[model samples]
Target: MYPISTPSHAKLLRPSALPLHDRGGGARTVALVSPALGATTFISGITEFDPGTEIPFHSHNCEESVVLFEGDAVMDIDGREYALQPLDTTFIPANVVHRFRNVSHSKPMKILWTYASPQATRTLRDNGEIRAVALEHGKQ
Candidate 1:
């Protein structure tokens, strides 16, 4: 972990300066704050979704909060779907199956997400594959 005791440890992150990792099906993510960046309690990042794209249903080992930043989206929690607008926020409990889908066919959607743990992990509902959340963005 990077040292946090000095002012030099502070980081200024710009999404444009980070690499976006493809999550498949037009979804991509950029991990911002994480253990790889000296964050110990939580991890955060932004995800951009192409029109009509959605991530696979998955669950996390820790609680997650997402705030919509652009375009319209649908939040799928378990088997139910909820419409979301710009600035809409959601708090999802640990182990709850959820996903975000961009509803527009010609526009993009983006969200800022934060996970409660530095060691968060995602488990795909389809094949039970697990991945470290930070690593998902190539941060570690």
Candidate 2:
């Protein structure tokens, strides 16, 4: 038997309609599907990286998957670098150190990402600072 609200209606979300958040180091994020949007199992979003910019090395509490949406990128996983093209996808396990860098000097790069857990947390490798993935877009 299903609960009264067990079957929720599907939602149509447009990236252009969502809010863009600064993630420092020339990176910005746009949260798409999440608990705030009634998602119960996982969370998804898109991240845009400015030209010649990269995010700091960090790991998540759960597995993560990312697909390159535009431009070229270099994904560093566990200290090894892998070149990525548009539509290239990667599945990263939990607690693995990784980061992404835009290889182009003029064009920006974008990636669509999803976390295995709804309540995911990230820990920076440099200072061990922890933060909730859901709240990432809420901060300046």
Off by over 4 Å in 1: 1-8
lDDT for residue 30 in candidate 2, whole number 0-100: 87
Clashing pairs in 1: none
**TM-score against truth, every candidate:** 0.90, 0.90
Against the true structure, whose lDDT is highest? 1
Clashes of 2: 0
Superpose all Cα atoms of candidate 1 onto the true structure and report the RMSD in Å to 1 decimal.
2.9
Error of 1 at 70 (Å): 0.4
Candidate 1, 1-140: lDDT as tens digits: 32233577788787887777997789899888888777889999999999999898999999999999998899999679999989999999999999989999999999999999999999999999999988887777
lDDT of 2 by residue, 3-101 (tens): 123245667777787778998888899888888667878899899999999888999999999999998899998768999989999999999999999
The whole-model lDDT of each prediction reads: 0.89, 0.88
Residue 87 of model 1 has an lDDT of 94
